[model samples]
Target: MSPSNGIQTVALAGVGNIGSPLAFEFLENGLTLSILTRDTSKADLKQYAEKGANLVQVDYSSEAQLTQALRGIDVVVSTLPSGSDDQEKNLAKAAKQAGVKLFVKSEWGLDYDAPNMEPVNPMIASKMQLRVELKEVGPPIFVVSNGLFATLAFSSFLGSLDAATRKAVINGNSAQKFSLTAFEDVARFTRLAITRLPIPPAGSSRVLRVQGFAASFDDLIATAEQVGGNKFEVAHKSYESVADKQLEPSLEGLIAWLLASLSDGRGLLPQDKLTHDEVGFKPSVDIRKTVETVLKA
Candidate 1:
């Protein structure tokens, strides 16, 4: 099938943070949707069935099982966590066997295409391996790369900001820029791409990039202060001090590399590359708004 053929069905694998909202968006649009899950007994999974989804229980480890479940799916979106590259690779093989017209890789962040790009965060290794394996594979794929999820712009997990202590840490200067998008907006834009994008014959490589708004680390700190109506103790560490070594496979380590990339120019989209406007989405939340909501929560 091609982009002009229109989408009749969409199957989403993995329903955590990004997956849950994406499932709801597809169902809300009244599409024929299938949700993949390992367990059918969860009450949380039942909600989508109530919302008119056909939940298929399948072992992601088995390519045959995933292929069978994906038999009639026009699109397969892998929202599996970044660490699950092996499963995603199997899913890709299955997608091809099942003749899935389009496979949407969970390409939500970073400039993976950057020259000299290292797996600063170990989780990114999954994406890197998938690309090397499938860059020329069939069942033309789709990727939507929006910088940081706005909800995570000031994530305490990154140790960049401690909301409780009101302390902000920076690597290098605060002027390093990166992008952020609200999670719901990501769902909306993914839906748009389903229609606006074409499924090229297998062997295609491309990425669709978008950003809610471009802001710097300093912008986040200031936004936090304004949103919370409290001042913060801020610190700046040299880039060498921040990213001189391999990051451990922890949330804080991954976040540190991500922040360091911003300063070194590996964390953001290029000037002419942003396509959110072309895809027709204006993010509902900006830096200030997301910080306000997150801080309030």
Candidate 2:
């Protein structure tokens, strides 16, 4: 059935981190949503079901199941994580066969289309592979290349120093500025694209790059210091140093490459009027603001 506004059903694959928040946004807007999950036993979905979501348990690894789940859906928003490129490829194929309209690939980190930026982890690999496969899909698909989630910079995963009382092991100082987008805002943007973006002409590839805020690593530490109301110990370690200490080659290699690239400014978006105009997002949180929120939480 054709939606009142041209697009009707939206299916979101994967409901972790950004996906969870994004799904909430869609539900809040009173849209018909179909979500794919591996774990029905996970309690986090209780609220989602109460909010009127059709949460389906499907194996991304199985093409038949994905195809069945995608039937009758008009739009597909992939919040699926890395290492699922093959599944995504299969889904895109199914979406095409099912007459899907818009398929958004989950490439929400650094801009893969950037001149110097390179894919480092398995996640990026899966994303890139899906992009290539999307070309052959009968329907139109788009990629949203949003820079690092601002939250990542503050979280331990990104190396927020976990020091006893004095020294924390952090990758960089507070001075290095980077851009970030809030989860809620990402949801709004996704909705806008689904509901408002003008369709691209017959045959064209569309890419939307979004930025939230730009600040340095030092900025984050300073914010933390202000919130904690006390000076914390600091330890500076090079990405190479972190790699040397890691025992696992895969883990170490991935971290080393990411660290070096981040340090080298490979993922840094170009600072220009045209670039900003093209990306079209003004983020809500600055470094200090983000730190305060984290500290309070």
Q: Give the whole-model CA lDDT for all candidates, comma-separated.
A: 0.78, 0.67
In TM-score terms, which candidate is top? Answer: 1
In the range 1-297, model 2's lDDT, one tens digit per residue, is 122447767889878888888788888886788888877667988888889989888887776787788888878888766666677777777777776788888777776667766535554555676686776763677677666776676556666544224335655333455557677666766776676665554334577766667666665566678777867677677655643433333655555555555555654666552133333445566666766666665
Q: Find the candidate with the highest lDDT and give its number.
A: 1
Question: In candidate 1, what are the lDDT values of residues 127-241, reduced to their tens digit?
Answer: 7668768655536877888877877756765667777788888878688777778888888888878866666667776687777788888888888887788999998888876
Estimated TM-score for each candidate: 0.91, 0.84
Stretches of candidate 2 above 4 Å error?
1-5, 39-41, 118-123, 163-167, 172-174, 201-204, 239-249, 273-281
Off by over 4 Å in 1: 1-4, 115-126, 136-138, 247-253
Pick out the ten consecutive residues of candidate 1 with the lowest summed lDDT. Answer: 1-10
Could you tell me the TM-score of candidate 2?
0.84
| Model 2 clashing-pair count | 12
lDDT of 2 at 267: 48
- Lowest summed lDDT across 10 adjacent residues in model 2 is found at 273-282
